[model samples]
Target chain A: MELICPAGTPAAYREAVEAGADAVYCGFRNDTNARNFPGLNFTTEEMGTAIAHGRARGVQTFVALNTFMRAGEEEVWYRAADDAVALGADALILADMALMDYVATTYPDQRLHVSVQASAANADAVNFLVDTFAAKRLVLPRVLTVAEIAALARQVDCELEVFAFGGLCVMAEGRCSLSSYITGQSPNMNGVCSPASHVRYREEGHDMVSELGGFTINRFGADEPAGYPTLCKGRFLIAEEDAYAFEDPVSLDVMDHLEALRAAGVSALKIEGRQRGKAYVAEVVSRLRKALSAPPAERPAQLAQLRRLSEGQRTTSGAYEKKWR
Target chain B: MQLPRPLAASINCLPLPLVQRAVALVFRQVLARHPGLFDRLGPYANRRFRFDPTDLGFSFVVYPAGPDITVYRAGKAPPASATVSGPLVTLLALLEGQIDGDAVFFSRSLSVSGDMEAMLALRNGLDDCGFDLPRDLSGLAGPFAPPLQRLAEAIRARALAGMV
Candidate 1:
């Protein structure tokens, strides 16, 4: 299977290519992409350099214009599409329908991939994207079981890609508004989820309390590892039991199931960490490359080496195994 | 009352190459485990990094040379083009990918000065190397890795406890 990697910056793009990524995806240094963090992403000039760098190394470079375009500021996202195509991105991964319509209409021959943020869960949703926008590939959301993926793969005309590893969001892609309710910056609209600007960490007696928009999302014991204060991954009081009401701070790593995913008609395996550093991209892509190349019997050993690198040093198969649901 | 800082200052008086060789031994083991890192950092092979750990109240320099990086504890300011300063744990956390480097840097917990490109390259290189000190050290140690890992954790916990 092709190993697609996330690159938040030009430097990380180079690192991903060197680490054996078949393709690397990034975004403009604006709200036009999902991971719009400060000191991250590439400028238009940097995008040109990155694509050139990737092409020289025989690695595909994709630009994510995946966030929803604001109603009045539609031109901002449209301009981003024009620039991405002009800069020679191998493909454009997009979620917004209006923007997809715009790109499909304006740049008819440009290769387009349905962003996971589009939440194209079922075969019909996948088909609609391909038919309406000529989307060459569907980056499926992390909500399907292996059986379901195979079923959808059998029905869809376009190639399918799945997030093989990275942070797992509990909410459905493109539909989550939890961060907006608290911080007024939704992933779909602003291209940020649980933006760092709104997050705050404090020490309360013996606990380290992580707050987002002044609401206590989680309180960790001094000994427990504290994660970023993302709303959906927080612990809360439900039924008088303090538990991870949404989801735990763990990463999704499914390297052991490459055979099953490939059999299910997965065209590419995408690692999901645009906010991560080059070290993360290099290690994840390199390990996945090793895992994919090894004999089926020897794959587990390679996967074991990745556990230490996971979030909170924990890894889960997530919805791929169906236990998360 | 102020003897610890003076004591640490005295320790910093050790020969730079001596401390560098000791650090280089451990870091070489880390790089040896991940060969892809050398390719990621091939562009900036000769860059120098000066790390100022305010919590530890000492400074050190690292020189990346091909497959291995040499570390130096400096008695005086390091002759590095780029210098990074942060709390000891924060610096360690950044290396381990425990926290986002940009987030910590923006929050003013970590600071970098001098050559921006070189600093950025080194940061990316370190990230690509994916060094988890305890985990990598344990892996290098083979059968005795677990005990060594526990000892490293103890040191980490004690060090972080004071900051909290």
Candidate 2:
């Protein structure tokens, strides 16, 4: 199986590849990719260099042209794909159907991978992309269970990729418009969601109140750890009690379940934090790489080491276990 | 000053327009320094937003909720006003000129509504107003006296010189 990793910047790309990623995915500096954080991502020239660097090391590079094309500005998405192709990316991970069509038609030889943003969970959606655009791989949504993955694998001809670690999103990957509804910024349109510009931390009385758009999401005492506030994972009042109603602030770690995933016919395992620093990329990729080679019974030890590296010191199998309530 | 819980809840839920104005005030203050940031904000500043006086916008209403200064234009449908919603920390980060609106929008850290054109316009306008940090932070220093006031005056003088 392939070890696909995120590379938000050139430095991170280098780190992931050097640390043993089979493939590294990144986006342009603009809204072309989902991890469109400021001071992160690659420029056109930087992308070319990064791709060359990866190629020299026998590691593949994938450029994300996943954002939906603007109505009158289709050229932007087109140009992004063209640039990625020009830079010699091994494949283009795409979500927008028009972009897929354009790429499939314009750059017939360039490999295409279906981004999880497409929310292609079932065999039909995966096969549709394969039949129509010839998608080489499909990054399945986080909503599926191991059994479902095994079933879907039997139904589709294409390779399957699943996120094994990092942040967990509660919404269906491509269909979420919650951020745009509140902040006018969207992952589909702008390649961003719950942007940092809207977060606020205030030292109120004995606790630090973390707010997003002036709404209190969580409050932490001085002794507690505070994570960056994203709305979906926030603690909120529902049924007269404050709790994590949508999802908890936990990272996903399925390293222990590698054997299950491999048995389920997954072709690639992806780690999700492109906006993270190089050190994080290196550590995670290296650890996962080791886990991939470890014996099935010994995987638990490696997973325990990874648990220390995850966010909030908590990890879940997420939807892969069919544990959603 | 101490209201009952029910009364406090009612009072806290002010109409959306007032919230918009308060957000506008924060934007105006932060953007006062950069004269070109608005144009740079591009399509993001084109929308308008509505908010109750107490409402900070969707950032507080949604995930990672907190006190936020929303930006939006009026005369739009509910939730469609050209508005940008984020936390005060995010606002401060933006004001420091370390962050961009596009980054915020994409990361799901900021939320928006309404007219895209108006929201973009507002963002661009504020971007144009650079941060006058020294002037804003001067109150934090000292005896609440004339020295800080004089320092603020000197900074203003330097600002005028740079503009000219």
Candidate 3:
């Protein structure tokens, strides 16, 4: 399986290529993509050079135009899709059906990928996108069990990509309504979830309280491993007790299930960190590259190195194993 | 984690002005080499960034708009739009894009307070700079550059090793 890495900037793109990414995925410096953070992503000229740089080194480039277009602002997304195809993207990862329809009709030969934001979980959804948009791949959201993914892979004709490491979204891909309700920004609509612009950390006594949109998201002790104040990962009053109502704030690491994913017809393993720095991209890509190339007996030691990089130095198989009640 | 006691004491004992002057010189060199470095900071370019090295003896106040940096003893540093507190080694590693900011922040080795967006923009800008302290410094160093570079590299390695 190919190793797909995220590159938020041109420098990170080169780092990913050097660290052994089979394909480097990035987006423009606009709201057309899910990672539309300020000072991140590439400009049109930067994307051209980045693609050329990666292509010269045998690395493929993927442009993500995965955000939904706002009404009357469809031209912005359309121009981006046209630019992506003109820039020679190996594939265009998209979530908006209208944009996908535009791409399919405009450039019949352009390779299309259904972004996880589309939440195309079942065979009907995946096949529908594949058959309609002629999507070459489907990035499965982190909501499925490994068994479920394998079953879906057997039923769909397009290649399947699974996130192997990085932040876990409790919401189904870009459908983060909890964040939207609080911050008025969501991945699908604004390409930001609990945006840093809305985050505020205040020192309350000995604990540090993180708030998003003026609501307390999490309060941490002096030594507790703190996480971003995304609403879904927050502590809330439930059943008259303080509890993590949704899920724990931890990263997903399916590194241990590479062979299973491969045997299940997964075509690629993705590292999800477009908002992360080049250092994270380089380290994760290099470590995963080594683990993938190592002998099965030696892979554990190689994979173990990534544990320190996981959120709060902790990782989970997410929904892959379905270990809970 | 704090710096080793002896090293911290040594740094503390040094004249604050001399250290400040040296830091300013290094900052000038970095700016010269990476002119548009802070452009990615966008609107936050004018914001003050207080890099409070929890392990070191001083805090640095950087004005990205001015491309200027002012250093002061830890508690004496002026207020800024945002403060990023971390070990000196981790801070340097982050500036050079040699360490993962999110990983270190998650593990509690780094902390950010006030104006989260400003800090985020600064971090993104620095990540794009691709800085290598020794190399960038050595370029500005005279004929004794090789030995100076080696010494800086050794010190950096030792400090980062202690951090790990």
**Backbone clash pairs in model 2 (N, Cα, C under 3 Å; residues 3+ apart or in different chains), count:** 91
**What class would a CAPRI assessor give candidate 3's docking?**
medium
Say which docking band candidate 1 falls in. Answer: incorrect
Give the per-residue lDDT of model 3 (tens digit) for A121-207. 999999999899999999999998899999999999999999999888867886769888998899899998889899988777767
Which regions of candidate 1 deviate over 4 angstroms? B1-55, B58-164
Clashes of each: 3, 91, 0
Residue A218's lDDT in candidate 1 = 82
Candidate 1, B-chain TM = 0.72
RMSD of candidates 1 onward, in order? 10.3, 12.9, 1.7
Cα lDDT tens digits for candidate 2, A167-282: 78868887898777667788888887877566555555646576766678887665454444677777888899988777776778877678889999999999998866554577
True contacts kept of 1: 0.09
lDDT per residue as tens, model 1, A1-325: 8899999866678889998999999999789999876556777998999999999999999899999988899999999999999999999999998999999999998999999999989988988989999999999888888889999999999999998888887679999999999999988999888875576655566566777888989877745655556888888888999898767877898777888898999999999989777656777788888888999888878777565556555688888888745
Give the candidates in order of lDDT, highest first: 3, 1, 2
The residue-level lDDT of candidate 2 at A236 comes to 82
Q: Worst 10-residue stretch by lDDT in candidate 1 chain B?
A: B102-111
* Model 3 residue B18 distance off true place after TM-score fit, in angstroms: 3.0
Q: DockQ score for model 2, please?
A: 0.02
